[model samples]
Target: MDLSSLRFAHRFDQVSGSAIREIFKIIARPGMISFAGGNPSLAALPDEKVSELSVQVLRDHGKQLLQYGATEGYPPFLESLKQYVETAVGFRPDAVLPVTGSTQAMDLLCKALIDPGDTILVENPSFLGNLQCMKLYQANLVPVASDDDGMDPADLEEKIKAYHPKMVYTIPTFQNPSGRTLSLARREKVAALAAEYGVVIAEDDPYRDLRYRGEMLPSIKSFDREGWVVFLGSFSKIISPGLRVGYLAGREEIIRKCTVGKQSTDVHTANLTQAIVDQFIRQNLLPDHIRTICADYGEKLARMLGHLEDLAGLVTFTRPEGGLFVWAELPEGLNALELLKKAIDQGVAYVPGTHFFVDGGHENTLRLNFSNSTDDQIDRGMSVLKTIFREAK
Candidate 1:
């Protein structure tokens, strides 16, 4: 019998691979100015500091870091991370589990809570990666409507009544692809709604620390009165994506279930990276480091916005207070997917906003990341996009 005749799991039936990864392959050509990924600026990575921290952690805890670690977390990191969450992140976590990245936190949450056909309410144009994660778990993803203030709580409550969803997933601060933040009032309402409806809220907030302007808002989890909210955080944006240190914080029971699920996943996040991040917190290195990165990224964001402003009536884009991406809408009937072919040919690339939608038919929009592009690159890439959209229109 041919092995090619084998049938795969039904969980994959509705799922296709990431569209962004496919775009990455096309833009890999030399001279491509990619606005396609949510990567931290190269200057923000702090290589020498990481090297110094690595050596220090190794000297202090070499044997344990080298040996097998707990599925819960590396010991020092667990302690430091909990303190950091309470003080810096503004929540008192009952339990916390350090995972490979916040990406894994999504996977483990789905594993812990989802069953085939279970409903998960999400923002209409939400983070694609977690949407795919829910699909892989055979979820019924229901789209909740959103405005500039982020997901509307009235719409969310209506969905909760209708769908009786198993979970509600949101990127409440500096949302992915759209760069919108949930308002303080809505944040409080969402937490209240979750408790009232007895639903789980997965507050994935990796980009919270990346804000370049305005006052910092409290997390949705901070307003959570019940055990219904879980906060997922990532060090990838602030430190190095290569380090892959991220965490899940929540009620002990829910966290325990994720911990059980994680045991079969990667077992635990790498000890070396956890220790390095631990030192970052214990030594109080993040405040100054974050300030430095914010300054550089702020300039880049301003440059990209300037280019977008030049587009004027031809297009409309979000003026995000802070975050890596700016969402843009081309004129109706001018398809971003179709325009991307012309853009790649012109040495520019971006993710079509259609892919971010739960039901996938908003062809007029696209997402552009400013953090990964330089002043010159943003100028060149946006010029290419403007030319393509103008000619297409």
Candidate 2:
């Protein structure tokens, strides 16, 4: 009766970051100020509208919302989402499929398109979950280098040529843990590379709408005329992360494949959430709500920027126009994780840059989340950070 035959897949054997689990444990502690989560700001969660929308959904679409939803997700909400994508993002209506969250949309794409040992080209400092998903599927993740301006298009193209990758994964808008927005030229370069190389580009854009300082850049999906990119958009940033509503858009053939894959994942996303999101959109409440979030976060980001301006030489960081985070690289020879541990002891927490990379990561790098901090807290945190920078140096 040996269970050795139940040995797990090779993909499951690799070690994971202890930092993630440690952060999870400390998150719920009282009086803890966390910059660890990449959550949309509390300013963004449309509570009043959500409550109103939920009531509307129940009053008008109660029975349908509570039932087992379609595997492709709610039709009315999907249609609304499709229109939003088409009108705002320059997509065709037939290309998008709603899912439980942007993460699930990524999962669906991975499951359908990634066979074991397939190559995945990823940003050097990349999203942890995307790396985790690729790892679970035994994807040979090739890391593409990047710079302050954001992902290096030439590096990505080189990787594509070398690996003939299964997919190129990116968080182009205010990239996670980096807050680095890809320039328009770079976006076009990468898009061209994807089209030329016959590789799929998976663009996860949850924070695309969260900008406080920058001009809008067209999405990579906007250049996806050849169906080379699968764009993932989420309501988590605009509505509520807890609701977990998101969608994926690509060529209908690829979307159809993902839909079939999703059918076996959770059957479908929760009907109640979709109904609420749909109701909110129909009532024309989303624009005002988004404006509120943008305004609040804009002030917060400004405060952080003001505080950090003096420490410019001692430390370096991205000043993202829009998005939740500002990525900082400590002066040469410092370790961000060590700085984080010291900062935590002094009543602050942030994610180290290691968690963001798919390959080589800078030890001196760290990410600060401005959306969650109060203006007073921003000052205090920066004061502590200045002390840490001096000590670490």
Candidate 3:
């Protein structure tokens, strides 16, 4: 009767813990000033056109919209996505394949490459979801140290020379939790190192298009001369998170492998949603919508950053040019999770910095989302955070 002795695979044992989910319980309290989620600015939605496009598409192709579609994903969605990737991010069209969301693409990639004990190189403080799935495969999770310039290239090279991970997973553009972008020189180093070591890189970049400031950098997929990188993107940030649509772009052969693995996962993403989304994009609504979204997020991010100046001297947080997070590190003696208890008691909530670390050392750090808050909420939140820091002092 002992289930532990029944020999369940290690992946099952590894998949259960989640940091954000536990923190979410506190944010649900009435009057809480939540800085925890990475959700986008709702004002960024092209609300006017989404309804218009949805109505028109359904009226134009009702039957097709409802029917099952390709295992690789809906044709127009893929085609529109290919055009977007090539023109906006410099990826080749044949390389991208759609998935339920970037999360599923992450799962698919891990399934495709990892065998128990195989190494998967990750940023020391990396995406929680990616960390969760990699552990599911029971792969040797090696933490690659990172800073504001993103993952350290020399450290990455050293890891490669030593461990030879099956793949190096990175959130290169406006990285989650840290809101850090990989520097151009550092990026070139990563690409060269991957190619030189025959290591595969999984470039998860859902936040590239959400830039509220600065110039664009080409995606890692654009620099894959040796077919050494697999890039993941999602509409969840730019569009509706509820839609759950995302894609993977890489060498065609590798995508084909991911596609076979994807089949056993969801079979294919929903055709009806694909048809609706495809119609909106191919027919020209997505661009206008994204522009509106960027503008909304830009303003909100500005508000948060401007107010965050209050935390200066006592703390430091990332000022991202794009993406949906702001990472802050508290004073040496404070634990961010412990501070969250005080903050939540004061009606403010945030995820602890330790949740994102692979080896778990950044106890005083925390992530904030500027996208979902109003100006008033941001100002009030910062005032509260400042009070907390001052009190801790």
Candidate 4:
């Protein structure tokens, strides 16, 4: 038999590769001003600092770092991380488990909790990557309603009543693609709901430190008294993404389950990276680094919002206090997927927002990332997008 005739797993029957990854390939061409990926700017990556940390960590613990490490975390990182979680993240974790990235945190959670056909409630326009992760686990992803304040407590309660979901996955702070944060009241309510309903809440908050404006809101995990909420955190947005160091913090039993699940998946995160991040926390380098990043990204966000203001009649977009993405909706009867062809032709690129939807069909919406682009690039890219959207209208 030909290899093409081979049968594949049924889990992928409804799942497809990420649409954003395809856009990344197209945007790789020379002179492409991409607003597609949630990437940090080159200037924010701190190559020099990372180089210094890498050398120091290796010299300090050369043998241990090169060797296999524990599934839980590197010992030094484990200690520093627990303190960082308590002081910075505002929660006292019963346990913490380091993973490859926050994305892996989602996978491990799904592996620990989800079985095929078990329902998982989600925000309608949630993170694309996590949505796909749930689908692969064969969980029925049901979308709850959301508005300016984030996921509605009323609708979320109703969904829980109707579906009796096993888990509720949320990107509570500076949510990806949409760039909306859950309000303080809703954060408390979500934690309460999880405790009452006996459902696990995955609070994916990778961009919590990327705030550009407004006061910081407490994490949902902070209000989680019963230990139903698990906080998934990442250094990808603040530190270098290439480092791929993220962690999971939750109740002891739940974290133990995830730690076991993680053992089979990559064994453990790279010890070298964990040690380097450990130094960052111990030396308290993150505060100053995050401040510099917030300043640069805040300016870019304002510039992008200004351009969007000029196209106010032509488009409506979210004004996020912080986060890399700005979600925009074109006029009705215009399709962003179709407009993307025109954008790529003009050396500009953005992700069509329809892909972020669970069931798909918001054809007028698109997501733009301002963090990776310079002011000149934003002006030029938004100009191209403006002309294309206007012509389409």
Candidate 5:
């Protein structure tokens, strides 16, 4: 028999590789100005600080870190992480499980809760990575309608009633791709709805600390009295994504299930990285670090938005207070997927927004990232994009 005749899992039949990752391959050429990934700025990664922390942790706990650790978490990280979650994240979790990254956190949650054909209510243009994760679990992803204030409560309730979904995944703050934050009222409403309908709310809030202009809002899990909301957090944006340290916080039972699931996943998040992040929390390093990141990213965001303002009538975009991305919709009949080819030719790139949608039809929309690029890159890249969009219009 030919090896090409092998059968793979049926769950992957409808799924494909990440569109953003595929775009990355195209944009890897020298001089490409990419606005595709939700990457932290290179300058913001705190390399010197991480190096110092890594040395201190290794010297102090060399043997312990090298040894296999528990699936639940690194014990010291668990202590500091819980306190950080309470103070910085504004939620007191019943339990917390440290994962390799928030991406793994999402996978663990899906593994724990979802069976094939289970329903998951998602924001229409949700995070593509997680959308792909849900699909890998063979989930029926139902889109809940959203506006500038983020996911609408009324529609969310209606979807919950109609679908009776096992989980309702939301970014809630500085949402991925869209950069729209959920309103405070809707946050409370979502928490209440989760409790009322017995549905799980996956509050994935990696960019909450990256705010530029607005007052901070409470996490959806803060209002979750019945422990229905699971807060997924990451240090990727504020710290370093290379470290791959993130956590899941929620009810003990839910966390326990994820812990068991994680055991078969990676055994545990790398203990060395966990210790470094634990020290970041314990030494109170995040506040000053986050402030530095905000100031720089805020300027980049402003510069990009200023460029977008030049096409006011021809393009409409979300004005996010914080986050890496700005979502834009070109005039109707203008396709962003087609525009991307022209953009790459001009040495610029952005992810088409249709890739973020569950059903994939919004061709006019595109997602731009400012955090990873320099001021000159934003000016030049946006200039290239502006010209392309204007000519297309």
Candidate 6:
């Protein structure tokens, strides 16, 4: 018998994510102008500031940081984080558990709540990573229809009644891939529904502060009267992604459960990173930093949209107020999967929208990221995409 014949866990039975991974590999080639990843602009990362903070924190408490720490979080970070969330995010969480990233926040939520075969309602085109996480937990991921206003409350109610799902996962503000925000009224409705149905709501809102145009809306967690909503936050968008600092905010009991799950996951998020982020919060550096990045990103967004205007009849795309991505749909029968190969060959790349869909049927859709590219890159890449679409037509 061969070692390859050894039995593996059934959790991996439906989790083959190789297609997009292959696309990412192509995007990494030299000279590739990639619109595939939701990465913060290099200019936005505070490398110098992070270095200063790291040295300061290490010099202050080097031993405690290097030694093993509690599963809950670093106390200094916990204090600053709670204040930041309450003031900036508009919710006083019963508890907050810092994690490696918001990605781990989702994983811990699943670990704490989901059991094999439990139903989890999701937006039709949700974030692929979390969708895969749900699949690994063996949860039944049912799709809910969405529009310009985000997940429709009516459809959500119908799905809730039909499936009686254990959880409802949502990226409420400036949602991933789609770049759509849930309306304010619907946010309240979602919270109310969660309480009525006894279902948990995972409100993953990493991009809330990335707004370029629209007014900021209240979080679903803010409207959560009961303890049903859990807010997932990340610093990857506004700060350095390599730092990998994010958090989960929810009721005490729920957070306590996630904290236990996190212990087995990665003992705790790196203490030095947490301390650096702590200094950022304590010094109130985010407002000015966010303002600076938003100015540049807003311009990039406008430039991309202007280029999209030239492709008017050829394509239609979301006009998002903020967030890193722009979702687009090509003319019917034109598959984005096929277009991607030509895109990569021409030194441009985008993620085909089909990968974002739960059931994976829409092939004419794609996602573009403007933040990572310079103005020249956006112009060149969009031109390449335009020529590809026109030739396909």
Give the Cα lDDT of each candidate.
0.93, 0.82, 0.83, 0.94, 0.94, 0.95
- Candidate 3 Cα misplacement greater than 4 A, ranges: 1-8, 15-19, 46-48
lDDT of 4 by residue, 76-145 (tens): 9999999999999988888999999999999999999999999999998989889999999999999999
Worst 10 residues of 2 by lDDT: 86-95
Query: lDDT score, residue 192, model 2?
Result: 84
Q: How high is the lDDT of residue 293 in model 2? A: 90
- Between candidates 1 and 2, the one scoring higher on TM-score is 1
TM-score of each: 0.98, 0.95, 0.94, 0.99, 0.99, 0.99
Q: Give the alpha carbon lDDT tens digit for every residue of 208-301 in model 6.
A: 9999997999999999989999999999999888999999999999999999999989999999889999999999999999999999999999
Encode model 5's per-residue lDDT on 109-173: one tens digit a residue.
99999999999999989998899999999999999999999999999999999988999999998
Q: Could you give the C-alpha RMSD of every candidate to the true structure, in order shown?
A: 0.9, 1.9, 2.0, 0.8, 0.8, 0.8
Q: Once superposed on the true structure, which residue ranges of model 6 sit more than 4 Å away at CA?
A: none
Return the top candidate by lDDT: 6
Q: What ordering of candidates by lDDT runs from best to worst?
A: 6, 5, 4, 1, 3, 2
Error of 2 at 212 (Å): 1.6
Tens digits of per-residue lDDT, candidate 3, 140-165, equal 89999898899999889889888989
* Deviating ranges (above 4 Å) for candidate 5: none
lDDT tens digits, residue span 296-325, model 1 = 888898999898898899899888888789
Give the TM-score comparing model 1 with the true structure, all chains together.
Answer: 0.98
